[model samples]
Target: MKLGIVRCAQTEEVCPGSKDFQALREKTGVFAKVDDAIELVGFTTCGGCPGKKAVFRAKSLVAAGADTIAFASCITKGTPIGYPCPFAKRMIAAVEGNVEEGVEVLDYTHGW
Candidate 1:
């Protein structure tokens, strides 16, 4: 599977997403569901608060050959930051609603 990850823009400075990458490498977390080897096609951040550009980012990742997109733990589970995005649900919905058909939009990469 070709995977694209979207992390929290706010947490990029404090975290380098090592854990997310580690999970991907080990097939832990959301990656465990993938039956084949995963290729990281894209890694980007939602464009700041409210995530108004999340849909566009997700679309861009899909256009870049990503068949599946996962919102990272920083955005959903809060990870190193300990503060989940307030607009996470809406951003996920908007991206899911906007992406092409058959594109899988997952809620998170490594946590609930």
Candidate 2:
């Protein structure tokens, strides 16, 4: 299962946190854990609030071979920020409803 990770678009540079998808990928070994069952084939941002193009990007990723789509914990889990991104939620819905029917959409978050 090819996986795609979507994160937030940061404009202001600052000391990054564990919220970073790449950092989490390294720490969690998500790809390695899944091994040949999954591949991190696509990565991108949700284009911030409103996330107008998110669905399109997700579709493109799926078209490119992503069998599953995942949002970074920071966006879905609401870690550090204390609130989940409305745009991310919207993107998830859009991707779920509009993308390929069987593609899996995952939220790398906890605590709802």
Candidate 3:
């Protein structure tokens, strides 16, 4: 199953604390993981809070073969090393409301 990762719009270079998309891909072993299981195929930012493009982008990813969508733990957990953006909740709600049907949304944070 192909998955999609939606994250904060902050650039990796600018946000040194941002979660590494490549590392996540490697750690999840999407390329080598068991067949038919969920795997990350694409990643993008939420266009920085009020940007409405996140909903469309997420929908497109799902249409393109993403079986699931996920937000990084930091964004949902409010870790000391990382702070959750207020827009994070809004984005998740938007994605949940607008994305394709049956696409699983996984919050890799505490109490998800």
Please give the CA lDDT of all the candidate structures: 0.91, 0.65, 0.62
For model 2, how many clashes? 0
Please provide, for model 2 over 1-112, each residue's C-alpha lDDT reduced to its tens digit, 9 standing for 90 to 100.
6777776554213314334444435535333345444467877777777677778878888988988887765566655556667677777888788789899887662222
Poorest lDDT segment (10 consecutive residues) of candidate 3: 25-34
TM-score per prediction, in order, is: 0.96, 0.70, 0.68
Residue pair clashes in candidate 3:
1-37
Ordered list by lDDT, greatest first: 1, 2, 3
Off-target runs (Cα >4 Å) in candidate 3 are 14-36, 78-81, 109-112
CA error at residue 70 for candidate 2, angstroms? 0.5
The count of residue-pair clashes in candidate 1 stands at 0
Superposing all C-alpha atoms, what RMSD in Å does each candidate have to the true structure? 1.1, 4.0, 4.7
Candidate 1 segments exceeding 4 Å error: none
Model 3 CA lDDT for position 41 = 78
The candidate 1 region of ten consecutive residues with least summed lDDT is 103-112
